[model samples]
Target chain A: MAYQFDFAPVLQHSDLLLTGAAFTLALTAVGAVLGIGLGIVGALCRAWKISPFDRLFGLYVEVIRNTPFLVQLFFIFFGLPSLGVKMTEWHAAVLAMVINLGAYSTEIIRAGIQATPRGQIEAASSLALTRLQTFRHVVLRPALTRVWPALVSQVIIVMLGSSVCSQIAAEELTFAANFIQSRNFRAFETYFVTTAMYFVMALLIRQLLMRLGQRFIVGRPR
Target chain B: MSLVKITGLHKHFGANHVLKGIDLEVAQGDVVALIGRSGSGKSTLLRTINGLETIDKGELVVDGAALHDGKGDLRALRQKVGMVFQQFNLFPHLTAGQNVMLAPTVVKSTSKREAEDIAKEMLLKVGLSDKFNSFPDQLSGGQQQRVAIARALAMKPKVLLCDEITSALDPELVNEVLAVVRQLASEGMTLIMVTHEMRFARDVGNKLIFMHQGRIHESGDPKTVFAAPQTPELAGFIGAVQEA
Candidate 1:
């Protein structure tokens, strides 16, 4: 017996799959914005050595980085309710994604900041700029320009990682695939269609981010 | 009063004492040159004056304000004291004119328009009016140093500290930067420079200090210092440079 590829069963639930795809994209969009915000804060904190705050943030990064994303999602969704704080599945998924992405972004951005030369810092100091002014005007811009490509790739990785949120029953693409497979008894066909949709989604996201990176980060006509 | 004074300055980095018991004085508008071999602490002393290097034990006064004590108003002292470095530390992301205008706009609270005008004037003084809009990398080493000079001058500092400003430039480019320094000195801008160019030090400096082993080995009129160095170390250093 040969493996038969049939689309009719999966095509019947296209609306459900489309809704799931939209939810996945929405989660990624929100998570990326929040994650990048956290990343910038974490990067600056680590770079600036903001005392106890930086130490605490360093611990947060280590914890998030060391553990699996699935465990992190379960902890936020299942574990937090025991502490009298409850969150919806979507909220927990987004939060977990933000935390995970934030840590990775921090490391990437920290490398960028460190790669800035000492000569540049000395030059800024010679201009009689205060430490804060030097960081804002001199150190930050060049560092960001240097690592923006890496940052974009990390963000796309974070987007793909959102599929892991299906474990928390977040109703994203993977969850929708699971639901359609059970309903139609067509696991292979359902997954095949969802996998193709995911490919398209990832490609669209990568293209969009590339355009954005060129517009804002590179800041040159292309 | 001397515009700048250093007495018994000592600085150590871990076990390495970079500057040991350095003493010097500069009257207003004096063009003083500090010449010495590498690792002789000439640059360290210059950096100490600008608070880039903290002194282990010393007193440095610039325009009657204490530099080493850490009690003197740093921003005020820095506002009156400008420095140009060997690397031509212009902000690479900014245009030449903006680089010149930064300190004035930020510290002096000069309006952007006024700051631009001042930057333009300084750029013209450095003979780089045409390159005002250019980036630092776009200019030659000589032109970049000129822009650095203009950036320093835009603050209208009473004293300008130069640390080996021409050391990184090509032989041909050296003269262009020295000419700008000489012009600034001629215009009565007080200049204290750490440099290796023997001829420029001999010709341009009103006073010369030759350092060896983190100490001022000799200090006098440039002609006297170059013609007849007082110490054996100075003699050996001059001899080595001459042979090189």
Candidate 2:
């Protein structure tokens, strides 16, 4: 016999799902901006090999990239408190997402920076541009343009990986789905909606980033 | 008065002595053409003048600034010297105008309006007035080299260094770039160029120095040097080019 399909029970808890979606978006928004910012600094340090920070960021990137994202979130939420560094589940979740995305983007952006032609640097130097000026003006935008697709994919992966925040009781979209399923016993329907919500978010985000790349990285047509 | 002076200059890459105990002087308004076979250290000598390569031992003074091992500020020295490369290394991301304006605005702190005006004037000088908004990739190799010249001239350098400026261009395109350099030469812009264009060098350059085995193998008036070479090395170089 086929199981009966139902929508009423899951639809009644739409408010919870909406709140979860909003929370997950907020986490990703904050994580992406700050994480990419961190990634730029990390990439600079590693690419130019800027002394102690280069070594430090190299270690951080290696560790984060090699380990599982779930374990990172668990360590931030569960383990940090034991070492007297306590934060709410929300803070721990955001921190985990930032660190995770930051590590991935650092490597991605570094590859772009390394591909810069030697002549470009010599030209900038010959023009009397300082080291900082050359990097900011001549080097960065092109580098970002080269690796933007990979960066966008990495960002989307981080956004989806945020579902693990629910395990820490962070009240993101997945947590809402779990809460609704537990209450109404409509597991399949709740999961289906949650999955759709994530797919839509990813699509929207890719569009937003692509538009941004065209406007800023590639420059507007005169 | 001499604008550039080099005395007992020496440069080595590992054990390979690139420039060995060279002495030279370039006066204001002089056009010096450096020509030689590849690996002959002519390019290395030009780079040393621009502070791109440091001297191992000896003195190099350009525009009253010393550029030896560790004496003078490189930025200050570079401000008075402009360099154009064979590849025409225009900043790919910026427009031609932006590329020309970047150094003046950032390094010299020229206002945006002033930098734009200077960029326009320099682009006009290079015959690229219509390409102000074009990206480097959008321009042909000759046009790109002209923009690179405009970018350098925007700095108002006391002297310009051209390292085989037209070597990478197509034969048909070489004259367009050479014409701009020719104009600069006629207008009395001090220039030191490393080139293989024998006829152009004879016509435009006041002095020609043939570098062989890291030394000034032959040096004199360009017409006389081409007409009567005192060294077998110089004669062989001219012969090889003619055959090619």
- Chain A vs. true chain A, TM-score per model, equals 0.92, 0.97
Relative to the unseen true structure, what is the C-alpha lDDT of residue B67 in candidate 1, on a scale of 0 to 100?
61
Least accurate 10 contiguous residues by lDDT in model 1 chain A: A213-222
Write down the C-alpha DockQ for each prediction: 0.47, 0.80
lDDT (10s digit) by residue, model 2, range B1-244:
7998999989899999999888999999899999999999999999888788888888888888786653578898889889999999999999999999999999999999999999999999999999999999999999999999999999999999999999999999999999999999999999999999999999999999999999998999999999999999899999999999
TM-score of each: 0.92, 0.97
Candidate 2, A80-163: lDDT as tens digits: 899999999999999999999999999999999999998998999989999889989999999998999999999999999999
Judging by DockQ against the true structure, name the best candidate: 2
Q: What's model 1's lDDT at B139?
A: 94
Tell me, by lDDT, which candidate is best: 2
Q: Tens digits of per-residue lDDT for model 1 on A58-159? A: 998899889988888899999999999898999999999899888988888888778888877776676678877777777776777778878778877877
Candidate 1 recovers what fraction of true contacts?
0.44
